[model samples]
Target: MFYKYETHLHTSEVSLCGHSTGAEMVRAYKRAGYTGIFVTDHFFNGNCTISRKLDWEKQVELLVRGYEKAKAEGKRLGMDVFFGWEYTHNPYGADYLTYNLDKEFLLAYPQLCRLSFKEYSKLVRKNGGLLVHAHPYRTAFYIHYPPNPKVHLVDGVEVNNAGAGSSCNNNHMAWKLARKNPRLIRISGSDIHSTEGAGLAGVAFRYRIKSSRHFVDALRAGDAYLIIDGKITDQEGNPVKEVV
Candidate 1:
């Protein structure tokens, strides 16, 4: 059986752009038949709901509210909930889906928002977390600068984003980028901010992921299948055998 997991998600409690609560998100993904989901809320450098006025400790606490709520609800429903966050490099709006890191990591990095992609990448990899460049070619009014993958600084690239209005996110370009840079890990995610897009895309594995750490290792080992537009495929978007 293939265990499906949503690698990118946001909760209303943590993301200003999110339209659903963490508990609501858990229920939605569970209903959509996902085995697990990562609560990748927008970080302090992004559109996070947490007030910047708070102390570092308080900011960290607020940042995890969504994941904690989802975890609680997921436990009640037997769905695995993992913690993650979307870190944004402002102005250009380059976002990264960061995994395998914990609350303690955030607490330790008081200068996190100030660090450049290169510095952040070094720190995250040194600490066992993997950073996946999200929607590299996306263009929006808020994105004041051109697309900057910062390819060398990322461990992976999100090749498909199946959220609403995904056309604007330019999955094709992301796919092309991943193809050109074979060293970068390839992943797909729903980028769901509400129930309407829950489980629209994900990564599937033959083995169940035990934790966020396991997820990082599994993805790096290329033990993942991409789920995009309701079909299963390999990282290169080629057809793959689907199993229940």
Candidate 2:
């Protein structure tokens, strides 16, 4: 049987762009047949709701509240919830989905938001974290700068982002980039800000992923299947095995 998991999700408690609470998202994903989900709320540079005036420690605590709440609900409902955050690169509005790191890591990096994307990426990889570029070719009004696909810096590239319903995210371009790189990991995400479209896209595995770190390992090893447009497929979006 195949196990499904959502890689990108936001909660109202942490992200200003989010519409649902952590518990609500957890319950929604559970109802949609997701075995697990990674709560990837917006980080400091993004649309996070936490106050920067608070100490770094305090910010870290508040930053994880959404994940903590989702994890608690997931535990109660027999679902796995992992922690992650989306670091937004300013001017360009390029967002990176970071995983495997914990609250302790956030506490240690008080200058997290101050560092450049390349510097922060090195630090994250040094500390055993993974970064995936999300929607690299997305052209939106808020994105003042051009696409900076730091393909070398990121561990993976999200070729498909279902967040923009009708708007074009130029997913085809992302796929081309991944194809050209060959070494870069390929992923898909619903980028669910609300429960209305929670299960439209994600990744699936032949086996259940145990932790956030394990999820990263699976992606790095190319063991996870991409779920695009409600179909399970490989990185190239080919038809794949069924869940039974």
Candidate 3:
């Protein structure tokens, strides 16, 4: 039961991203041998404390269009695609891969600052959604510090984000912090923004996962491995070289 997936990615619809289209991303993932990927574009509120201005509706439209493009390409290439978005928690924290989110849900809840992490997590759970902490170690452009242990919330932590070079170190630190919390699952992603970056980071599941729901369930159930440089391993350092 092995699954190859790149969980975090962006398209041109995201004003900050370099890639122009989701079809391009899917082509890259197909060439890289990825079984699936999550298309997470930037979901920023205009009144956010961070001051980044983005049209919520346009972003949602782009995401939906991207999902369609990626799905069509994936079908031709024999891969799976997941619709997702990167929601900023402002100033120094954010979450990625809010799976199974609808446009109305995003539009209705434009102000993330108004919701507590607990409240937000509940909303996501109530909608059958999943969360992934994106690039916990990168502190340059968007300063994202890891969540405090006392405020234990989130479905999983992304230990490997290829776009952020320091993600490995961040992953290690997150692993240490999350060790005592069995409810918190460990996962990895590419956080890809370009064609070259698409297959750069991912998690190899212990069981084959072919859909977004199955992939999310695997993370929540703690049954996956991180894939880096072709080597697959569990959070505890168990070697899984079959994928390589």
Candidate 4:
């Protein structure tokens, strides 16, 4: 059996742009035939709804509510739940999906939003986590410059962004970029902000991914494939023409 999981998602509890609550999102993924999901709501610096005026501790508390709710539901339903956050690089709209890190880590390093990719890489490595550049080719609305985060700073790249289509996200360009760089693992995400966003993309593994660690390892080992348009596809957007 294959294990399918949504690598990126947002919940209304934390993300101001998200249209569904954490529990609602969880149930949605489950009903859509996913085995798991990563609750990657926006962090304090990004499209978060939380007030920055609050103290750092308070901010972390509110920032994790969505993940916490999803985790609780996941446990009750026997679904795999993982915790991560989509952190935006300050002044740029480019985001990174952080995995294998916990809430305590965020509370301890409240200044994560200010760190450069180099610094962020060091910190994430020290904690044994994976940093994936989310929608690396996306252009910021306020900033005219396109995002070009260094590849060495990230363990993976989102090659197939669900939010990206013909006019938006450079998924085709992103696929070519990752295809050339052998070191960077390729990934896909729905970047789900609403119910309509669910079921657009994810990752599928031949082995059961029992935890966040397994998910990270599977990605690094190139043991996962992209799920798009309700079917498995190659990183270059070609249909596999065979079911997993």
Candidate ranking (TM-score, best to worst): 2, 1, 4, 3
Shift in Å, residue 6, candidate 2 = 0.4
Q: What's the CA RMSD of model 4 in angstroms? A: 2.0
Candidate 2's C-alpha lDDT? 0.89
Per-residue lDDT tens digits of candidate 3, residues 1-244?
Answer: 5667777777765536546577888888888877888777766531112233447565455546666787788888888888777766655555555776766777776665477766877888788887766655555555555445322556766666666453356666666655766676676677776787556568877566766677777777767877765557777646666734
Q: Candidate 1 residues 107-208, lDDT tens each?
A: 999899999878989999899999999888777766765754678899999998885443454888898899889999999998888888677789999999
- Write the number of the candidate with greater lDDT, choosing between 2 and 4: 2
1-244: candidate 2 lDDT, tens digit per residue: 7889998899999999899999999999898888999999999889999999999999999999999999999999999999999999896788999999999999888999999988999999999999999888887776765655778999899888987642254888888888999988988998888899878789999999998879988888889898887778877889786855
Q: On a 0 to 1 TM-score scale, where does candidate 3 land against the true structure?
A: 0.81
Instruction: Give every collision pair in model 3.
Output: none
**Candidate 1 off by > 4 Å:** 164-169
lDDT of each: 0.88, 0.89, 0.67, 0.82
Whole-structure CA lDDT of model 3: 0.67
Give the least accurate 10-residue stretch of model 1, judged by summed lDDT.
161-170
TM-score of decoy 2? 0.96
Decreasing lDDT order of the candidates: 2, 1, 4, 3
Task: Give candidate 2's error at residue 4 in angstroms.
Answer: 0.5
